[model samples]
Target: MFSSSVHYWLEFYVGAYHALKRGYSNMDVLVALGTNAAYFYSVYIIVKALTSDTFEGQDLFETSSMLVSFILLGKYLEVVAKGKTSDALSKLTELAPETAVLLTLEKDGSVISEVEISTQLLQRNDFIKIVPGEKVPVDGVVIKGQSHVNESMITGEARPIAKKPGDKVIGGTVNDNGFIIVKATHVGSETALSQIVQLVEAAQLARAPVQRLADKISRFFVPTVVVAAFLTWLGWFIPGQLHLYPQQWIPKAMDSFELALQFGISVLVVACPCALGLATPTAVMVATGKGASLGVLIKGGNALEKAHKIKTIIFDKTGTLTKGKPSVVQTKTFSKIPLLELCDLTASAEANSEHPLSKAIVEYTKKLREQYGSPSDHMMDSKDFEVHPGAGVSANVEGKLVLVGNKRLMQEFEAPMSSEVEEYMSEMEDLARTCVLVAIDRVICGALAVSDPLKPEAGRVISHLSSMGITSIMVTGDNWATAKSIAKQVGISTVFAEIDPVGKAEKTQGLAVAMVGDGVNDSPALAAADVGMAIGAGTDVAIEAADIVLMKSSLVDVITAIDLSRKTLAKIRLNYVWALGYNVLGMPIAAGVLFPFTGIRLPPWLAGACMAASSVSVVCSSLLLQLYKKPLHVEDVPIPAGPGDGGSNLV
Candidate 1:
């Protein structure tokens, strides 16, 4: 009994005294002193009973017991609630498999055998075989065979990606089709999945700006309450000692000493700083987890808090709004061949080229064959292929010399160019499209107009942002003509074109700007903006510098991020109002402020229950944010009446 009281209970008393010595106070000190007062006073009553064979008033051993028990219960519930806020992160960590099947090559290296080994034992350059319906154990490139891998969990992309020889596969992704041999390139912590998990853990531990406010308020809250409790005791006890108290003002069951002690203890027991401390962090925790589930990763509380107030969102033109890769948007042919035939001839000639534009033309032709029909059942292979570096490519296709490239390639080959072809190429260049002219037997046959097309959702998302009264601006390092043409198509009116990376950052200074980009050049601007959002498909430099990452790589998630932030901030404000209001009204009532009127007074045990209830109420309110659902469309957001009328009704 002595150890329990001296060791366990004494810690609270010591902490309370320590806080007092520091010229501040805390909830622990108030709780410890409040319960100890009731217990020590009761001990005096017990000694009086033993000496005089008569006890006066009540002995409150039960009051102290209930106070400790209720507060302990509240603490346990708070821990449990905080655990639930991180469930999404737990689910992500569970995606990786523990073991992998190592592939051992037989003599002559023709046949291979499988040996099951722990994932930790795998290393770079080691070969592994993944069967259909199994997870890829580590990041690797396919060395043999072909299959489809589901990378939805890692990238938030729903469709399965076709994995062929030389294609890279991420660890933890599921193989959905044929078996494949993979040579490991990255292992263990070096994989993308591991990095994402670490980022989320760090983000959850970070504090927001509002949490600092709550901390400042709590530093003064406990000290003020302790003084209030002392004043309440003095006010009643002094008047009663002078025999000036009215009968109706005092409780029926007690005299001045009993009444004073009851009111003073109640005042200390009912005051709660735990509720105020939990208001912001708990809401941020749940909101971050909710964002991960929607493919939007919020790096920390500062990003979440700032994202809610973003007035202007600046988007980088090239990779953020567009597909970030050249595609065959328009194709025209002058010869007797059809459009699809011209594409097939161009694709066959450009298939062996390593240039991005050439690869785009080849890919477009492959898609055309799948959708419609191939012009030739078997594509003729090109011979004596030569790349002219910025000019184009030339090869002998089926004994006929075929050259596919820009006008420079056509001019060097001395290919015949008609007035009609010149007009066609000029029209494409004016629209910011790269022209890939196809020539067979030194005759200009056709041209493929390649360009980076805007993402299907970009225009709609920009229009939606405009409707929300939030200004959307386009910032890019590209030429003004190209930037203006892309901006007009995407519904953006403000364009900051021909600006360098450093200039992009300077343009956003002193504004609540959200810079969205996906390139190495965008890193400086991303770091300078109030909130940096990077596309998942972006370079490593951009992603590392960003505050938020969009795993879906869709412009719609920008809207989702902003909307989620507003909703999360709303929950935080709601929590603060509840906690502050509860303390403001309950503290005075517990101090017997109503005793002189209706003769109402809170007992010590009742005050303890109210304190526990207040903390639980704040936590429960934060948990309601888990019910948040993203809006389906812009129309789902309620429109305001005027321009300056407080932001959108997103909540």
Candidate 2:
């Protein structure tokens, strides 16, 4: 008895004491109460027999000792299972290499010397060499050499992507072949891998709304069980004293008070509040970690809870549904100026812009110059660069007022668009292309017809969402004709065009909407929707405003996020049912409710085992989320035909 008390004092008695001091009761209080009662009562019985020669009584030391042993064993197993739920997080943290090949660069942009150094010493603008099969040490842009990088661990992309000069590489991804020199752009905590780890850690600490129900029940659960145990003792002892049952039902060596004590001890140990307390958090932890592995970063339990109910998903047109990498497909000159000169002025004005369309224009001009055999490595500098949201950009390039954007920018600057320019824009819009009008010195000079192709999976993903009872809508700042053309290609029935950032949010006002986007204009809508999923490659503003982030930047992950949420919520419900059902049925049996009818009763030691098993079982059930798989398998689905094929390729 002394040894058992010493073993359990800190684990149970002290915890119970602290809980009472804080004005609350927990599972430890029940454990301490039940074990102390059994232990002290057995001591009392032994003392009584020792003092009197004729008196005898049964002792319960074995019951108290075995109960604590079983409870402690259960706790150990529960902790081990909980650890298994975070294996994904552990693997992620292990991806970054400890050492990197740092290269010293000369003034002429040539390598001077190379030395191996710890990755912790890496900083922005430092050049690092990555060889075949070595992990990239930090987020950087490839400055020299070419390779195929395996980004499966970081982006969940199974296929390796080809990398060349100017291509961006994420830290922790492996170089499949060849050697490359990378200039680090982000290091330490600013790296994508570090950000993902921090997000997952925060998510696991967040509590789900459904967990509150479990918490509310647990707060009252322990005290209620104690009362039930006392009533059970009264029910057995008073009835035994009144001869309410057959005297043969009592054990031969035990009297009414001893029998009552046995029933009370059994009741106390059988009702497990620990199971109820563990039901929700264990499941949430496993789900969040599993989500991180799949390149879906759920911000917290609140986002996970809201995602499952998204019946309407609003998709931003340019980057969300299309490839977001626009290329100049056709160019036209409106004035007497040469086409090459027209592109030169436009590219110069757009050089300072970060918009995807501006980059496409700049790229096109560079290629155009190469094709014309006048390849120049520099563009004329621009001054007074201005950005008009949802319109275009303007700047003074080479002493010329250059305005490059859509028709709205021309209208804003009162740049006259002649009949030919209007005709060219209408034709491009009908073909699902954006016409970027270039106005030089208040005179319309030329236009570039840029086309951002629909993502190959966009049509099929939309079709799948429709089959799952979700409605897909398109919202964009583009003209109505271009928006409708793109929507028709992707099988979306509804479209909203010419909407600014605030208007996009207003569009999601009255429905359970999920917004998927990758630009600054999408931030307001992302914050307003029931759930917002930002593309990992998107602007930081959009990512910060989103509830979930699709790190792979693939449209298919939208389906994965929603499907995973539904499955996780279902698992949580099952956990609750199991925990509550165990106590409701176990308490009555422990109280000997079936003893008279079937000659069966739950002994105190067996009741302790059952209580321990209940808590362990709940944690194990949560660990099952580690096996979760994406519902939509990209490999299994056939590639859709060209855009406007009405999703005929969906399998």
Candidate 3:
């Protein structure tokens, strides 16, 4: 289980030891003596191979040494850089629950007691007693009592959430005081804490893919250097110089060729793409680090690549585009269809529904019932109900045919809408209120306006994108007018309204969409887009589907994300300039370009040493990423509420 660089360095050093043991006499001065012999032999071979055909330079000894040294140096630097970038993920994952308060079954009335157990054994529905200042062992619903829990490790929020019976608690969150019993709902890998660890692991494994232009240029450049080095040796082999060898001209030509070969080998040793190989990942590591500090999660290299191209954005109506706080505005009592009866019908149909819209309707009905006294006596059965997916519902309620849906449901029954009602509906609908048209028997009763507020920073985030020359758009399951109104308010001009999951993906196609959302419904859209950004805190599905997951879950991270991409791209370009510039100067020198005038050719040892310097320079350039601090401007959207909005519940 050694990290890549460890294996790279270990093999290099171990091979160096073996190479010296076989070639040199002294085992005690293994490293230094081997290095000298390798260099001297390389110089002999390079010059000899260059000056004469009767070449006598031993091939393997010097060549193997040079190749290993440069590679080991490159690898050592990489390991250190990766450790720095890995800090955020490592620190977050360390917050896992260490132990749990285990409960064992007893015969008489299930005697309750606690024992310590491994965190892995915690499961859904298992009741665990939590005390103040202890970390909650797993994600669960509180079964008894209440307490405030600090959840900064998972959500990146400093504020603590007050948890009561049925309130969800995440594993690793500290229970700040008060005894409470928690019924585990999600455990182990299903927990939010575990998911964050998994996502980070997956992102690390992904190949930091190369830019096409850079890859092509490097591919040809490496071989060209190889070819040029060969030609430098040929100049020495062509014969006709002041005694290149000792004694005879024939043997002298061979010695001259050997000297040329040494210099040529030095060129090869110096020519490693060590710095070039690191250009992208170094910048990427810094970019992701910048994002992490701002509570933004750039999942991988591809996310860093595609975020610059987004033009149009999409959203889901009930949750993503709205505040997710749908409330009742208007309700009418029909003599035929009573207000209480309508409430009963809608509430019963939505009893098992978890959608935010459905929850709002049910809660609104309960509040009305609590205010206006008991409902009229009417027979109702929980068994005789069915939920319609897109539109509203049709159910047999006390043998009476009741149909409650959107405007389309009224249109299907041919119920005429009055101008006064129509005008009220039209005005509210224009403002992005979801108007549900209700009906009982053959008559249109009245309309209900349930409005979900716009997210606070939605408008500002879109405006920022436009300034960056990136166009912003939204796709949502909301009605056309509702979607249009939200788009207008958010500074988004284009939107695909009334789109389901499949439609969301199709809309994502054509435009280089960066879908930003934080709910399960947005999962498909996240997978479909050129890049998906899951914004919001601790959303499991959003974390999974998106290329980038927002740790803070704010709309402002959208701007930060794009900004990081631009910055990282610039860094990579700078690294390329340096790598290419170094080679441009060094390559010709290795080719005997200065031969006749200077009368001094580079020895193999000196050339290899110079090559190592270039690679080290590249390594130093990559380390500059540590200085890239995330921008200081972080934005937060205040949660909205109005006169009629429900009071915040403890959770």
Instruction: Assess candidate 3 and give its lDDT.
Output: 0.64
Candidate 2 per-residue C-alpha lDDT over 1-651 given as tens digits, one digit per residue, 9 for 90 to 100: 777658665678888899899888888898898888899999999998999998768999988888888888767666665576456677777789999999999988788999999999999999999999999999999999999999999988899999999999999999999899999999999999988989988987899898888867867988899999999999999999999987889887688889888999999998857788778778888888889889999999999988888899999987788877788888899889999889888999999888878888899989989999986556988899999977789999979999998888899999998999999988888878888899998889899888887777898899999988999998888778888888887899999987888999999886679999999889999999999999998888999999999998888999999998999899889888878887898999999989989989998889988888887788888888888998786675566554332210000
lDDT per residue (tens digit) for residues 481-537 in model 3: 777776776667777776667777777776677787776767888898888888655
Number of clashing residue pairs in every model?
A: 0, 0, 29
lDDT at 367 for candidate 1? 83
Instruction: Give each model a TM-score.
Output: 0.81, 0.92, 0.78
Better-scoring candidate (lDDT), 2 or 3: 2
Clashing pairs in 2: none
Cα deviation of 3, candidate 2, in Å: 8.6
Tell me how far the alpha carbon of residue 563 in candidate 2 is from the true structure, in angstroms, after superposition.
Answer: 1.3
The best candidate by lDDT is 2
Candidate lDDT (C-alpha), each: 0.80, 0.86, 0.64
Better of 1 and 3 by lDDT: 1
Write one digit per residue (lDDT tens) for candidate 1, span 397-426.
777788998777888989978999989876
Error at 138, model 1, angstroms: 3.1
